[model samples]
Target: MLKFTAEHEWLKLEDGVATVGITSHAAEQLGDLVFVELPEVGAELTKDGNAATVESVKAASDVYCPLDGEVAEINQAIVDDPSIVNSDPQGAGWFFKLKLKNASDANALLDEAAYKDLIA
Candidate 1:
């Protein structure tokens, strides 16, 4: 299942790892993404810490880590083509995957409805 942080990072859990990305709301807010800097595999990430960065025509935004974990993988495709983030924020646009240090954190993340409330 996919869960979201108030900061706009989304985590999609599968097996034991969580795939992370910026939500469509965030992409929309940023305007048109022109660059994306993704976390490296094996990097340690803290909850609420900056894990990635996205630059749009309007502004640059830091993408925060929604949970504490070690980065397991990243989408090199985004780095090669940043606009994919704005085009598909939730799917092919995923930034990275983390090997969660605490699975319980996933339970605590917001669902789609709560995310809508936050964005609204």
Candidate 2:
């Protein structure tokens, strides 16, 4: 399932893990990315906590943890080439995989229509 936070983070949950990234709207707002810093594998993250950093030509922004979890993996491709995030924020640009502390917590996040309205 896919869920989104008001902070503009998206989470795709499958099994007990979630792949997290900035939404395309967020990427557009940040302009072209120049740097990305991901959390370490096994790092514990709390809901709404800073999970990663993305710096663009316009500004730097934090990618928040939409749900509490432990970092299971980080995408190195985006770190090596931040522009990938600009091109595909929801796909190959995902920042990390998280082992959710409570998968049910995702239920409280926004759905596609709600998120679209939020950004609209």
Candidate 3:
């Protein structure tokens, strides 16, 4: 499942890796996606810090790191085709994975249920 931030990001944890993305609500709010700034693999990130950027026709927004960790991988394909974030925000549209500087960080995020409530 996924967790949400008050800043409108989404996080999904699986097999100890956290997959991050912007929520559908966020994508819709941002309008048409134009570009994506992805962190390089192995880049160290500070929790809640600026990790990347997402640009839409309307504006550019920062995507917070959400956790303190090294970036395990990034979806280069999505950077080339930002529209995927609008069509599949949680699936093929996933942004990056943080290898995790601290496993307990995931515990601080809201769960699927709470995230749903947050958006609603």
Candidate 4:
């Protein structure tokens, strides 16, 4: 299932690992992305912890971990081409993957409908 955080990050769980990214609303608000700093693979992360940083022409934003987990992977494409984040924040622009400490934490996250309501 895919879930969203109040901060505008999205999480999509598949095969036990959860893929995470910023929502398009966040990207739109940030303006053009200039840089992205991702968490190290294998690093332990806490729920709601600062996991990454994204800098745009407008401002710098922190990407928080929605749930506790270990970093399994991060998207290199966005590092190479930050504009990908502006172009596809929820698809090719995904930030990282996590081996969740507790999969049930996803239940606490907002669903797409709720997230849309928030960004609206």
Give lDDT per model, in order.
0.90, 0.93, 0.85, 0.92
In Å, residue 10's CA in model 3 sits off its true spot by 1.8
In candidate 4, where is summed lDDT lowest over 10 consecutive residues? 56-65
Give residue 104's lDDT in candidate 1 (0 to 100). 81
Model 2 regions lying over 4 Å from their true place = none
Model 1 residue pairs with clashes: none
lDDT of 4 at 105: 73
Please tell me which model should have the higher TM-score, number 3 or number 4: 4
Report model 2's TM-score to 2 decimal places.
Answer: 0.97
In model 1, which runs have C-alpha deviations exceeding 4 angstroms? none
Instruction: Give candidate 3 regions above 4 Å deviation.
Output: none
Looking at model 4, the pairs that clash are none
> What is the Å distance of residue 41 in model 1 from its true position?
0.8
Model 2 lDDT, full chain set = 0.93
C-alpha root-mean-square deviation, each candidate: 1.0, 0.7, 1.3, 0.9
Off by over 4 Å in 4: none
lDDT of candidate 2 at residue 116, scale 0 to 100: 100
Find the number of clashing residue pairs for candidate 1: 0
What lDDT is reached at residue 81 by model 4?
96
The lowest-lDDT stretch of 10 consecutive residues in candidate 3 is 1-10
Put down candidate 1 lDDT per residue, 1-120, tens digits, no spaces. Answer: 979989888888987799998889888888888888988889999988999988987778898998899999999999999989889999999999999998887999999889989889
What is the overall TM-score of model 3 with all chains considered together?
Answer: 0.92
Sliding window of 10 residues with minimal summed lDDT for model 2 = 56-65
lDDT per residue for candidate 2 within 13-59, as digits (tens), equals: 99989999999999889999999999999999998888998897767
